[model samples]
Target: MVFESRGEKVFRFAILIVLGLLSVIALLPLLSVISVSFSSGWVVDLNQVTIWPKAFTFDSWQYMIDRPDLWRSFFLTLITTLIGTLLALLVTAMLAYPLAKKEFMIGGILMVGVVITMVFKAPIVPYFLTVRSIGLYDNPLVLIVPHILNPFNLIIMRTFFKQFPKELEEAAFMEGSGYFRLLFSFVLPLSKAVLATLALFYGVVLWNQFQHPLFFITDTDWYPLQIKIRQFITDPNEMPFLASRQEVNYNERTLRSATVVFAIIPVILVYPFLQKYFVKGAMIGSVKG
Candidate 1:
């Protein structure tokens, strides 16, 4: 029988305590936001703020659902996220696979170019001008085209591809499997974990994108959820309900919290389904090659 040392037991207990404290601290803000969102009144009393709500209400959520413009923006965000993520994953895999091959004639030079582009971001104004010149400005493609080939995602995918067993590629070549067939049939199937991670990342970025729509897209009907939230917060007069209630009540804090809660709901709903793939994908993609 083996006996545990007193010092080792004390060290383990200290580590557990630190981890527990950190977890509580991280969860506190999210818990507070949720509590405030469900509170009954229009005003949140800062002095009376607590983790548990004093009075409960679903009025804010109901109000959000009643607004047609908000629902339209939500759908726009969803469509954009799906389209952009798909395009990004497809383009990234196409570019990364070739770069991952050592036998490719220009692999070294191409890799260097990719690294340099990642290091030196192009000026936003010039890029915007180029997009306008190409007739993509203010178009749905505008959201996707500029970010389709993210260098960081490409690098991670290339590293993952490089880690694939070389013998598999050789056997596929001997079986007369063309690159396209091999890529779709074999490579992609095995790379699901990393691909799922990148898709989630790209989707989230596209869903939360505000600056692009604010600058390039002028049409109010084409605005995404984030831009809508910004507009609501900035110009309450533009919101019909708020404008109607302007004389009686004007509580900015409660409105802000409501908007935040609405914006976060989609992300929260998405995380649970994709979480298992996310951690594994990130670990495999980042820690390898």
Candidate 2:
């Protein structure tokens, strides 16, 4: 390594210190949430609110585990995330692939349409009315269908596909391979990084979706985990033993923290595997013409 001047060394050290501080600041909230979740009760004393847990307890986790409704909601969330991400990927790929081609006459028009849709979101009431009219109001389709092809994701995928080497497509065409065959055999395999990135994006969105289910789904059985957590936090009266002073006051704060911890665990678990792909994909997808 080249020797650094004193000034350069000082500058580099300053930058490193700033970055370290920023990282800790960013991580503080997550660490606090985890601490609260594992804390014995909701009203953690001010003295105990440190980086490390004052006293550890699994009561929050135990409480959540014993709730059948929470489990059901979690299952619903998983199903919705899986189905929504897969569908979103398919629809995004289909729309993006043709748009990626310069030869496609209507590609520009379609792209403009997508941009317009992204810019001007329809009012909630009218959208809800339309969903009800289409008879998808209570179904899981209500959540998945509305977001099947996110415009930003479409744009990213289109950009990624456009970056593919023209020579590859030309060679495939020379071999008499059709568009679908080329897409299936060559384009898709090469685009896995971008696809994985989009999948994670869509999956996270689906998993965290709360408003759609809150409005469209009336049945308690169909509520997603987020909705369930919201209900628990907001409507403490609905929870058993909360009305009596003889029982331990369920710490809503602690419960909320636990719920958040549980909610994020699935995404956290899968992120490391796909993180490499995410960065590569984002770089490829953000390239402008």
TM-score of each candidate structure, all chains considered together: 0.88, 0.90
Query: Which segments of model 1 are wrong by more than 4 Å?
Result: 1-16, 239-251
For the record, the alpha-carbon RMSD of candidate 1 to the native fold, in angstroms, is 3.0
What is candidate 1's lDDT per residue for 1-289, written digit by digit as tens?
8777999989989999999999999988887777776675544654354666545666666666778998888888888788889989999999889888887899889888988998898898997788789987677667667767888888889988999898998899999998888888899999988898898888888988877887688788888889998888789675446546644332455556677788888888988888888898888778866
Q: Give one digit per residue, the lDDT tens place, for model 2 in 129-190.
A: 99889988788778788878899999999999998999999999999999999998999998
Tell me the spans in candidate 2 whose CA falls farther than 4 Å from its real position.
Answer: 1-16, 42-47, 242-250
Q: How many residue-pair clashes does candidate 1 contain?
A: 0
Residue 125 shift from truth in candidate 2, angstroms? 1.9
Lowest summed lDDT window (length 10), candidate 2? 241-250
Cα TM-score of candidate 2: 0.90
lDDT of 2: 0.85
